[model samples]
Target: MDKIINWGILGCGNIANKFATDLQTVSGSVLRAVAAQDLDRAQNFAKKHTVERAYSNYTTLVNNPDLDVIYVATTHNFHYEHAALCLAANKAVLCEKPICVNAQEARKLVELSREKDIFLMEAMWTRFLPAVIRLKKDLDSGIIGTPQLVQADFGITKPQEAGSRFYENKLAAGALLDLGIYTINFANIVFGSHPERISGYAQFTNQGVDQLSTYNLLYSEGRQALLSAAVALPTPHQARIYGDKGRIVIDDFYHPQQYQIILNGKKPQQVDEIFDGFGYLYEAREVQQCLLGGKTESMICSLDETVAIMQVMDDLRKQWGLRYPNEN
Candidate 1:
């Protein structure tokens, strides 16, 4: 029988709640503990999730020897600090997306994880979804026949309040990090290569963070991706992949349940997938398998890929004159 993997969560925020709830669906895994800055919040989350323990401090949570891995679900600005803390404690980590504010921090965390020889992965849940698996398999099978141009967008209409995490520059609030990463990762999945040239534009909030942004990624041989993300602006949240011989469309590329495939001289086909527990359990299961296999990282969402994606975002932010509070 496989050893049951124990889990802990750092930071009891909205994303944390989703992850905790979905974690219950992962087989051979247990939510051993959770921690938040506030004692009350931690206790409440623990109770809601039926977790074994809760602590007000992250250090206490990370030091819990029973936990095999910890998920860092804090805001963007705190990911590097929290993930690094876990790694320092010799705890495996599954950090939230956009892993760090910049590539520099991501590289450092990657180095530390390697040094520790502990499992670590960016919780890119989409990469583990059955739909995405099917999509990749179909693409590799030449169903799309040489994807040429990709168009994708992710946007959420949030109120422009500086106090909210969505608009707070201190929290590293920006559409590029929060929503745009989805579009960027989608392009990465389709192309399986980094863009040779990246150009971007953004609309900034009063707090100096991007309210909305668009990126154009030019790959070799004229392949390209046009993508956008927003906090204030509304978009269709759609994605399209155009190839020399066919095309595919996804209604919600971020967490798609269905997509349409249209090929030249062939009838259009629709693919649909169903998943339980908010789609996060897939990544959680990946973490469990990596730990069980004694692997330090997941190839599907490798640390190198995470760092590379952060570099792309860093370049786009630099071009837009956007910098978080901690950057040089």
Candidate 2:
């Protein structure tokens, strides 16, 4: 029999709800506990997901001996602290994207997880999707040859408001961390190293948060990646990779529904995979599988990869003079 990993959620937000629903789609995993700042919210989430325990305080939830892993679904700014707490309790953690506000904090979390011998992974869920897996296989098979240029973009329109996290610097709200990390990580996965050069620009909110940004990265091997993210407009969320022999295009790349591989002077072939509810099931299953295998980090999203992605974001921020209060 497969070991059933007990799962705990540290936030009751929309992302947490998606993860809870996906947990139901996979075996060898159970949603056991949930924590939220508000008691009623926590209770509601727990009851909705048939979770066994609910707490208004995170510390109480982390101390639960039954939980095998804690999913840190908090906002970008809170990921590091929440993940650190779970690690301190000797529990595995799957933190949401942009694992920390900066590379320094991400490095700290990685070190602590290694020191404590606890599993910790950034929840860059896209990397685990079937479509992405297929893409990686296509690259490895030499169908695309050596990738030379990769492009990806994600954007969404948001209302300008002082309290809106997308426009608030205090919340670490910005296109770079919120949306661009997806493209950056995608590039890293395909390119297999940090870019040799990074240059970018952004449009800032009245409060100094990035509303939109575009980045260009140059690699030592003469490769390049063009990436963009925005919270002020809507885009197709598409991605494409150009290699020496062929190219691959992912429609709606961030949450792709379909993709195509094109070879020189050959017809474009379609590659597609249908996802179960919410597409979060893949990452949840990954965590369960890793725990059952007694692994400390996911092969799909290792700590090294997480840190490398953060380094890219940190460098871009420094170039653009973007800083959150917590960064100081």
Model 2, global lDDT: 0.90
> What is the C-alpha lDDT profile of model 1 across 214-314, one tens digit per residue?
99999889899999999998899999999988899998888888899999888989999877779999999999999999999999999888998999999
- List clashing residue pairs in candidate 2: none
State the local distance difference test value for candidate 1: 0.92
| Candidate 2 structure quality by residue, lDDT tens digits, 1-328 | 9878999999999889988998898988888899999999999999999988999999999999999999999888888899999999999999999899998999999999999889999888889898888788888888889999999999999888777878888889999999999999888878877898999999888889788999999987889999999999898898999998989999878777679999989999998887888899998888888888888999899889899889999999998999998676
Instruction: Give each model's whole-structure lDDT.
Output: 0.92, 0.90
Task: Give the clash count for model 1.
Answer: 0
